[model samples]
Target: MGTLFGTDGIRGRVNQYPMTPEMALRIGKTAAVFFRDKTSHKHPKIVIGRDTRLSGGMIESALVSGLCSQGADTYLADVLPTPGVAHLTTHLAADAGIVVSASHNPFYDNGIKFFNSRGFKLSDALENDMELWILDDHKKPPVIEDKAIGKIFPVSDAGMIYSNFLLNALPPDIKTRIGGMKIVLDCSNGATSTIAPNLFSRLGVEVIPLSTSPDGININDACGSQYPETLAKKVLASGSDIGFAFDGDGDRLIAVDETGNILTGDQLIAIFARFYHQHHLMENQTVVTTVMSNMGLGKALSDMQVTHLKTTVGDRYVMEQMVASGAHLGGEDSGHIIFLDAHTTGDGILAALQFLRVLVSENTVASQLANVMTVFPQILMNVTVNAKPAISDIKGLPEAITIIEKQLGDTGRVLIRYSGTQPMCRIMVEASTKTEATHFCGQLTEIIKIQIGT
Candidate 1:
């Protein structure tokens, strides 16, 4: 009965608490009833998509059963990316969309996220209403008549449709420039395994794909954006122009330059912002990012005369700020970039294409393009904790953080926050040198663990 939604959605180990089949069923029924009441459609339709997790089928079946029971037609787009579900929801004009995957998490964990009819993540109010319905003890409504019961349909071409959409979204000149370009891709053995290879090959790029074979358990098994070392090695060995690594659900991207250097999400965003501004495509000449973004990105944006807005540590918050400020570009430091003019949500493949477009249009290599922003030395430490005690509640934590802030002054920054989806405290420090950042991060993490350790 606790709050079932996190920063992203309801995520947990499979067969546990909010991720259980029973919980999924209830969520589906609750969502169906809520959307039905909000819309005038006689039979509200919900499109469902999932990644290659082993539990995806189990969760999908439970959701479909519950949705149909509430007279909400369900369309299953099996094994598609999260953004694809969002796109298909709006493309099909469905009432809502559901994606069942834990994104970058391992196969042992899973999650459920919802998108409104406009392909945007549901608002907090809507999520709260659904949680209430799930917890309510009111009697269930009568079952619909046999003919009135919702039907389930299979989307046979969902992946193809999404792939084509991404292909067409690229700049027209990309086709000619990308031809004969050698590129390596690491699909994370998740949703992008099939679609990414196909799309890149059709675009006439020499595609060297890794982790395209998904056995469900292999997704994100040391090969995705979270672990770009493998991709970097491949890019160097294959002598490819660049390497693109996608997270499990294809909502995140991390790139490896030709020299085998990994590029952070902030660097990519800086590149895109500069390109968009030079081309007069940047709306309001602004970019939105989260607090977790590197300080160098802010400095780079300032140099370019583009306003930088920082939001909470989530892509949804970034998107909300982008929409509010009329900014066409926003993303997180974790590689979740949103191109408002292109797609409703972050699409790894699409973002990669945009990155490629920058390279092609500028007639530059990945290393040179990534140099658009100079990243300061950053150190992040995740300390496991028994509970999420507020930093103010922890004795001496506030004074210690304040001292570090004053010592670093304007040359660096410090961010201490608890993970929204996990039981840990993240300590991030940026300084002029790696040694300073690492030392300070180690000190902060030890303090946190002593105060809140299990």
Candidate 2:
């Protein structure tokens, strides 16, 4: 009875202890029962989508078996992005949406995340209920009666439905403004392969789509948001107006300007925040970001007279903080943006659309999008370390942090975090210049290695 769910969902190496087919089956059954709403006149329906993982099929079958066993109908949207599943769940008025993906994690990892009927992620209380049900061996949902077994159905038009929804959500003027916009899209060879190109083409933008394969292992290997260097090169070589890359689940997005400059989540958020504020669309004049956000973001927001709030590292945490604060925009530095007015979760496609909306409204180039923020030069280094080191309890870690803080003063920032999913420590530094940032980050990393025995 170990904890199966991670920061996002139940993610781990496929065929491993927590991610095994048997566990997936139990999770499906537990979710089916948990989401069973007797008040509804119709039967409960759950939409499930997966990434291009090689193990996707095996896990999908197990999930379907469990859901059907509990009298819950399941719709199989094979190889769709996580955000697409979230959108469809709300569009179809289903009881819930389930996404099978490991997001930016490697091909060997897989997971199951879900959205409740409100088109939002399951709350912590709900997650705890399901976990308890899954762990209690002797306590199970009542076995389905003979005539109540559920059925599995294939959603053959999921892609088309999602594409249509995206197009319809945009203003007609957007197409005319974007007609000559040259853009390159890296689909990460995952879920967006089914929808992004179609969405962009409908908007009358010139779209050059790369890495749009369904090959599971190849996805995000050297492409996608995690590795924007390749996309930056492609943008430079093609002389494209700009480039956007999506992670395996298509909920995170990273971009490169025409000049081959990679823009991170904070920069992108700054662009949107400024645009929304100008148009008076930014509700409450606040933006939510994770603690991992660069200090430059706070400074920029402050200069703009916009309040910025920080939450935990995960996008879910950001969303929770946003909703509680009644904020209109929130996201993580990893490119998980939530335009709460439009969608319920972090959607790469939606974020791209918002960026385009701003670009068209401002009538400016991509490079100028975040010009006001002048992103501080930042460097990050991750080192694999032993499992469960006393990172917070390290003897000299606090002293080292104090030293870095004093050095940074008001012009820079430093952050050291433990990898949520791996045995690693991530050290990040930001300064006025790249050389300074790199040097500072290197010294701090050396200190960590010596102190933590990494």
- Which candidate leads in lDDT? 1
Clashing pairs for model 2 are none
lDDT tens digits by residue: candidate 2, 1-454: 1265656877888898788999999988888787885327245799999989788889989999898888899988887888889888987888999998989888888888888887788766677777888889987778998789788888999988877766665678876788778889998888898689888887778898888986778877888999999889988888888899999999999989889999999999998888888889886999999988878788889998999999877788888888999998989889999988877889898888878877887888899886867777889998767654566676677777788789878888888887666557888888878998898888877867776644
Among these predictions, the greatest TM-score belongs to: 1
Candidate 1 structure quality by residue, lDDT tens digits, 53-140: 8999999899898899989999999999999999999989999999999999999999999999999997777788787888787945
* Model 2, global lDDT: 0.84
Candidate 2 TM-score, C-alpha based = 0.94
In order, what is each prediction's RMSD in angstroms?
1.4, 2.1
Compared with the true structure, all predictions reach lDDT values of 0.91, 0.84
lDDT of 1 at 48: 97
Q: Which ten residues in a row have the lowest lDDT in candidate 2?
A: 35-44
Model 2, position 148, has a per-residue lDDT of 92
